[model samples]
Target: MPAGGLDIRTFDAVKALAFIGDLSMGQPTDHSLRTAWLAAQIAGAASFRADICDTVREASLLRWSGCTANAAEFTNTFGDDVEGRAAMLAERPDWAELLNAQGGPAQAIAPLAQIHCEVSGEVARILGLGSETEATLRHIFETWDGNGMPNQLNGKAVPAAVFVVALAGDLEIFSRVYGLEHALVLIAHRANFRYPATLTIPVNTHAAQWLDTLAQLAPAALDAALLTPQMQHSTSPDLIADVLDLKLPWMTGYSRAVATTAAACCARLVADPEASERVYRAGLIHGIGRAAVPNAIWDTPTRLSAAQWEKVRLVPYWTSRAGKQMGTLDQATELASYAYERLDGSGYFRAVGGPALGLEARILAASAAWVALRSKRPWRDALSDVAASELLRTEAEQGRFDSDVVEALLEGEPTATQSASPRNIRYAAETTRLSSREIDVLNLISHGASNKEAARALNLSPSTVRTHVERVFRKLECTTRAAATLKASAMGLLR
Candidate 1:
């Protein structure tokens, strides 16, 4: 829905985040979006301002945004946070059930509630929500009179969005678990205190029957949704690279650190403006595919099985898929997809020869490997800087990575400390939007087809195709076919 296609501003942050809540709640996919829509309708009917209703809708969808930030921590504390939330739909906990059960359910449940609330508030703050919005999110679980954890500000002080979102969220859960009739009865009973009397009256009035109204709506209502143009788009080359780190809570800082180190390594190379930007973009989105992989695998400190390794290999592939739907990002996507490839054909998804992998991609591959080796993951503690360097060199010697990029990373750097600050790096690289013809030419170039072959395929004369290829090369800054390939890959030109 963004004017320039699928840049950062194209994807609705609220809608995308609702998917996360759906995952956390163990709901059928897209359940959060539907619940959000239903909640917005309820808010609209309750004399709420249109913008406030929209905010409530947005908050309903994104209220669980921070849950992914600490998934491992949550899983550790509660046997399975994902599974526990799933159970909430059908089962009501009895205090007597706790008294008769083994160990401490009450103690565990309280902290989990507090942790979820606090983390949600933290994510709201990080996303730059307004103060009123932040306050609403913080008190999402508060009872009207007082009892919410992580500090309850009580009734009137709570943001309207929070009150509507909380009630709407629970109503959906209840409706799904029990019949709609039961859900409405429950809301009517809770009306005065737990539910705001004004909002509760309408939800009890229409929502129980209107639950089926969503069926009249199409799927991927989310697909048609738009992010406002006012949101700042991250054009940093590290955009996708840094995004990968956000796949889990504990990894919040990993992608940014790796991107910084990788950019520093690339800085030592020939500074073609286009190539520099391409490499940075590759670093940011390189790990976005990790979203398809479950947090269970990501958080495991133990070794992985063959099945897990296969799942791991698919992350880059998925990252590429995510980019294709976005406009004008082909080069960045391609680089991100192939970031794991090795020169010796040891990587995944069609293991092409070194010629297909391009210089920019090679730099990204090496940089990614170096940063990954240096960072701590579930299976291992971070390697010493010296050890990480040795590992990179070992890979280079085996012809798996570009020696030039590796050398640049190592130049004037015997010790492996942090790379240059990401904040200091200039991201003012000029970007030209690619036209359809240019995109077609670049896609063929990525396949290692010559200009003549591309011309035949596109029904254009060789001269015209050559001109386009030359322009693409100049715009992307590559003298050789390999560099062009890297840029294309970074932009996600390849499928």
Candidate 2:
């Protein structure tokens, strides 16, 4: 795909995570990049060493990395997770009032924050960031006064780099969301709480000048900071797919299913291995931009309002922007951005006709549509393969999908396409060292089964099943169920 074999590991971990983090936080796509840039400046001005400044920059980029892991909880706490979190970040005037109306204490976010911290920390660990960066991210939401999320550690107990990053984030977010005056007011209000006064005071004095200068350099400078050639531990773009799918439970493993089918279709129809592999990668991340929109919009069964639809159309545009920050994933994500386009010029973000579209674009679009058709949606039962094929063929006839691509998906389709699931993946079971019973348990839990549910299905006691699940986690070296599932999938042990 990139003049060599499909080397999936070359994905820029910072860009992929930062893009997802920004979307989950309801900030602009470059929000994390700007935040990281601001954090580095603050850290630099504080006379921190270059390495510490680098940690601050990276910590800021991944500040919201765990946001998706807590999306459902956030939606339950606040109707619109995106807007609610965005409002909280900007310290909107009515944010306090809105929280009061919820009749929930500030501490309610602790559990959500705990989940957030653990997942973010694990992501950092998996990405091979240093222990300091991981530690800083785990404490990113904490404050100096101990009125923070998760641990609530006070006054110097938190990592020093975190405070600098926090102050920088405030300056960047408030200055952009509100104005410099209100931003300064907000930053000053948080002195001795959000960060040490030593780090906080100078920002109020120089933020205007700093932000003005940042505006000139932030675009190129921030991009350079966020986009790297690769990480020490190479990461897969599938991680991006996994993290995004977490925001919606029903969509578990959805990306892989799309990818599996897309690859198979491309291989059969196009007969180009490299092109097929590229399509597969695109399928895995086609919905990364869907993170920018809230769960509420995607969960809707009915037609989206005109305003809501406009936001949905920008999904592709956001995906493309993320691509720019992604180093090796540049082309794959660009292909992903076109997944929604239709050959009839009836698609969104860009409405180009059949003549302008490439074969890979057509294959990805068809593959994505077919996957959606076969997969279950909130409003309806999953369509059977036959039923999905009928609908897909109808769309192809109407010029919405490429007829050949649609036929390729329908013809050479994996019988397990609906479950185009991990069931069929090769089992390097010995590699995971999981026993048959443990494999069965891991498979069940990975599909969203609870311990009791898995136990019942396996005809084993819940305690035994719990023990087995714990063993699976230990062996897989995962903490969260999502992490366990991902690792198990990667190990080909999910089956």
Candidate 3:
């Protein structure tokens, strides 16, 4: 995005992401946190360095982080991706037998593994976890044996942290899903294949004790343990937004679009920059709980059953749960979780309406509804601009959405071939982390201005122009001048 970025604590983001992975994989909440706790204990027994222990913990939490990337494929391979995976992780003998079958789960593993590896690796990088953690995640699917997806590195070629994380993850997952005795048997059988035997010994020795200690922790205590403070990542919170969109192909860029539009609407609604900023962020993560639902449910063409609709309603509840685990992010996440709530008290998760809703929350709810109306979904084609506008206003009239907030969303709809909407540009810059002055420079450059030309247009020195241009290129993930121009144009930053 050409807009500004939000700052989130590295652990906070990672913990939220871990929860997403757990949900997608059909595991209990804090499954990853439990795994991390187990892994850290194992690392301590082994006397690994604090940094290596940290790597082990992060890798364990993120092992399944790429589950969403391959969710659609998993749904196609297995009848239900979530339930199928939960069953696959059960401690039966040769439980992954179907995973190796020809044209069965085997055919999908290669591509799915690659997708998972790349996505999890990106998460590791965004959190600024060093090369060790990143490498561990990239090969998280690989086994101690030479058989793995994408890359087939075996033995020492795989990161040492991978084996540790694997052992710990299996301990948490298998024990809960298949009982301790069965889980231990499965872990023992995987000795050299799943992980080296030396690694298995300590786990076998302390497995029960570790699990008992984990079970002893109260819910609040467990949450406190997982939400430990850490250095904040200076990147955009949109990374999680992008990850959420990945679960459904049709949803690509939907979150960012909502974020930009909601911020723009907030600007129209009130003069509070802080309110605008919070609403924009809420827009970005409004669908954070979508990971818990299967793609089959999301991509269903037919009308959903009562059970399915019930699941849909709990989506916001899950998002709220995720927020509760993340320290200090309650406000924005709370606003986001209210995306489906209606002003008429007809929404899911919570039905309170009218006075209970604040201005920023109203903006997010209206923004999400408006954006979803404009975008295509499996059940329906996207509405035309005028049709969507009429429907939004009509819903407001019926008290489903706040009328004033709906008005703000409709204000200044941009023309297709003409200049981008100034309201949009302002929000984009703010949410994308660019300053007003930078937008001015980008505007000049987008219209084919040279460095000196941009400087002249903005009344700045050539050095300053060069600086802003470089920053824009970096922020937009473009290298060449043409690339920057094209990206800026897409972002509505160009004139």
Candidate 4:
């Protein structure tokens, strides 16, 4: 784990999803994380199984994960989705009035329907969630009285996680926006209506305690327990998936899938175990940078304007940043970021030729593209496997993908392995050297620590922590914490 906080992976996937949720609705940030913690406590108090508690926490984070993927539609009907959501929260309205405010119902139905299904599906698939969990997310908006979106699943049809998350989410929001007493009252009022009556009281009670204990708990206390020993023991494949997903919802489980696919492909090419593990880890974090990007750009349904596209292109940079913060991922970060580059100078950030690109990078690029194409998107339906293959082939012929890597990817061939081939593993010559304090700050940042949290951990003022963060970015040739972390990992400073 990095200094400022844990590596993005150690926390529950739900926390990351909740971050996206908070961003989607423009809520006071950290609402999702707080809510998730509350939900976990509620689950424990209610005597839910340990697996159920974990599931509840994960669901709480994912409940709103899909909300951002449909931002364009929400913005179109509501005129700025973020602002509209904020208004709705400030003044709770009747369902009828809320629908009417959503552009007189007619214009809103399609977008709303699209939002419900698309978001539900995206969140579930991205997390590699089980069908039960997916069903839970799909029915998150259902009412006990049989009025909700799509198919109205009433009461028991909803999963326990849904009930727990819903109750906790509402409780946290109300408590933060209003007061603890008011939050309790609100929870009581919504019981059996928006909430499952049986779970509401327990959830609300636990939430109240959480709010009271807020000051006493360590910044990392709740999150620290969510991770498994494997994550800390060694950066396992599942650990990588967890880390990437927790950092960026859009990239939930993305690295894991890529790692699995790439390692399988590479294994056929060679039998060196260490090389295989390295290749796998490389695949696991290829999209960590996607976390630094706002959900608005990531979930937009329409074609990105030129400005938005630039933001899209920054995901790799952020991935590299997180790697640098971890101390031993600098080379991995570079390969991850360059996964988007074309062989013919048509790629982003850098346009280095295919020959110059690493074999790991070429496979990562092809695998990422393949997975993305086959996976559904807000604007377009997912492509068939054949269609995705053809697209990769087209890019390869265009001089974007490496010829051998493309063939391997298309034919299901293995990653070519030469016995521990020499590779560049240092920070770019242009990268600035950060001080030890700056590196510490960067590590805390990659773990999602707030300035206050970082300050407390390091015995520094919030203002001082912020200053150190700024210095880290300047010296590392990066801007965000995610980027700085990746730069450090590239330099082996984060380890």
lDDT of each: 0.60, 0.76, 0.74, 0.59
TM-score of each: 0.64, 0.87, 0.81, 0.48
2 or 4: which has the higher TM-score? 2
TM-score of candidate 4 on Cα atoms, chains taken together: 0.48
Q: Whole-model lDDT for model 1 versus the true structure?
A: 0.60
Residue 488 lDDT, candidate 3, scale 0-100: 46
Window of ten residues with lowest summed lDDT in model 3: 415-424
Candidate 4: stretches off by over 4 Å: 1-16, 89-99, 103-130, 203-206, 227-495
Q: Report the number of the highest-TM-score candidate.
A: 2
Write the candidate numbers in order of decreasing lDDT.
2, 3, 1, 4
Index of the highest-lDDT prediction: 2
Q: Which regions of candidate 1 fall more than 4 Å away from where they truly are?
A: 1-32, 88-106, 113-115, 171-194, 197-201, 204-252, 266-275, 288-296, 307-314, 317-337, 341-345, 348-361, 397-399, 402-405, 412-495
- Number of backbone-clashing residue pairs for each candidate, in the order shown: 30, 0, 7, 24
User: How well is each residue in 1-495 modelled by candidate 2, as lDDT tens digits?
Assistant: 222354444227567878888888888877887877778778877899877887887788788888887787788777788888898888776777777777754555777777788777766765667788889988888988988877778867898988988888888888888888888888888898878889976676677777777678745565665443234336555566766777776676778778778888888876567887798789888888888888888788987899889989998988888888787788999999998999999997899867888988998888888777777786777898889889999989998988888887778734342231232122234344888888789778766678999989999999999999889878776556766655555454532
- In Å, residue 154's CA in model 1 sits off its true spot by 3.6
Alpha carbon lDDT of residue 331, candidate 1?
67
